[model samples]
Target: MFILKRQDVEISSIQHPKRKQNIPILTYQGQSFRLISVFSDHQQEEAKAFWRELTDHRGKACVLLEETDRFSIWGKVSLEQLRAEESSNSAVSTYTKACILVLQAVYIDVEDLLGGRQAGLFQKDITNLFEKLKFPQADSPKAVKHWLNVDPLSNSSVPAWEEHHLITLLQELYRLGKEYFGNTNFAQGVRDILQDMPANDQNQFIDWLNQSALGQLWQ
Candidate 1:
């Protein structure tokens, strides 16, 4: 069931949603597995299943966890508990690893679309993507839920992916774009979009993310 967290204090869960429940998520480059199946109860078994689904032919995976003390040596912990400890906690550390996985996937996709990896175009898109990743969000999910409750653009009608969740997605797209576009004028494209949009629209920083060069890379 793609368990995001479990721990001694409390188990915080973030299910992938009903639609994605049956989908076979690609954990890494070559290994693919169906989340519809059950995860083993034993920690070693659980770790093995996760490894088989994520590791490539060369036995490498994008996700990494160096701080092993966060859990009861079982590697079971939730995102919520991790965030509660402190600003710099194991939860953030784990999420950072997940983010890297997302980045690698998207970057490869962009490269496929653009043609071949060109240094010039890649640098521009990479720079733009990095800037968009800097937007700050509330630490608590409650704040985000409150915001989405009021705003139309933030509605749950669309599969609501947390902004923090997109870090990996954006990183992947940036990598893919570089591999495909072979170094073109990505930044200028973003600038042009900003220039054409209304001043009020300019106030919405995420609009840059929603409808510009950065957005395109994200797609």
Candidate 2:
């Protein structure tokens, strides 16, 4: 039996035409895995909580999306989402992208520190350690879900050196702010950019920053 932990699973509803209401089901590659009850009044809140739990056990947990057959690492998903959202021109979106890049750099650095990659395998044992901080917009949850279901091990090459590059980019952003807006504190500049973000996004960004290398420097 393929037992899945409740903490590792997220329940999404699908239409049940005959029943005239939505039914909560867990499916993987068109196979019915489990049926779970819908108890939470707010579906988005429940999903966010589930994601946080998954993030806490990222390396140990295997994320299996109902729409995909393969399990994926948390880091791959975070990277995919970061790439997807990086094009947005909004202030919050830009700041969030930078933060994700920083986290990814740290992740890669840690992987390098543990052991140089062995030939024929791409850090298979390294956990992708990051959270899906933003809630998916209602218009494209399925697409977002699919994008995050990436198999990190499928890649043949290690990520290019990024820690110093990303740090330089962050410093450049801070410099631009100081030159153009007279904001001396980089953290304050980040706060200003995030001013218009929704409360949930702001809170998630704060949490992510607190765990980042930049956050350590700021402190």
Candidate 3:
């Protein structure tokens, strides 16, 4: 089982001063994670160095992102590099991107529930990243509805905006698992994380997974 433990560390205690923002010190099982984010070359270099430090222990590493930070040039360049590295047999990079997508989805859902300002920005960044990853396009209202498992005739009966965002999140999960982890282990990894989530989130994600095209994989 995968376990996530989040710890609060002082700024003065941060080993890398230059890459300080949004840095969450998360641990899976007993392995410490090196969470990195990039908004420029300097941050990108820091991320690369962090990756190197993992060496044979890279499986414990992942990415940390904020909704506002994902749209920057630094974010784009950093993700592009990570995606490229994924294709080159870097398991750590692949898992980092996958984990980021899941976290981004959860962030969007929380923001929408609370009527937060950054929901739109999160949605846009999620869409852009999915496109860059070559996942199926949820470009049209109809496409979004399909992915969300909403009945076409009930479109007017549902909250379209929330449904659309949920679909985007589900599709990212499905595609990431399918494209990178052969649609099996990654689904299990997601299930492991879901088990640790709040009851509300667990129910929501479980419902979506059961309704999605990738439902059988999860089963």
lDDT of 2 by residue, 93-122 (tens): 434344443333333333454344431021
Model 3, CA-based lDDT: 0.37
Candidate 3 residue-wise lDDT, 1-219, digit = tens: 121112322111222332222222333334343332222223444334433333323332343322222211111123334335434333222222333445444544436553556544444554564444333335543443343343322233322122223333444545443443343444444555545444655555555555433355444
Instruction: Please name the candidate that would achieve the greatest lDDT relative to the true structure.
Output: 3
Whole-model lDDT per candidate: 0.35, 0.35, 0.37
lDDT of 2: 0.35
lDDT of 2 at 106: 33
Lowest lDDT block of 10, candidate 3: 68-77
lDDT of 1 by residue, 34-114 (tens): 221122133344344434443433243223221232211122233353344354333333333333333333343445554
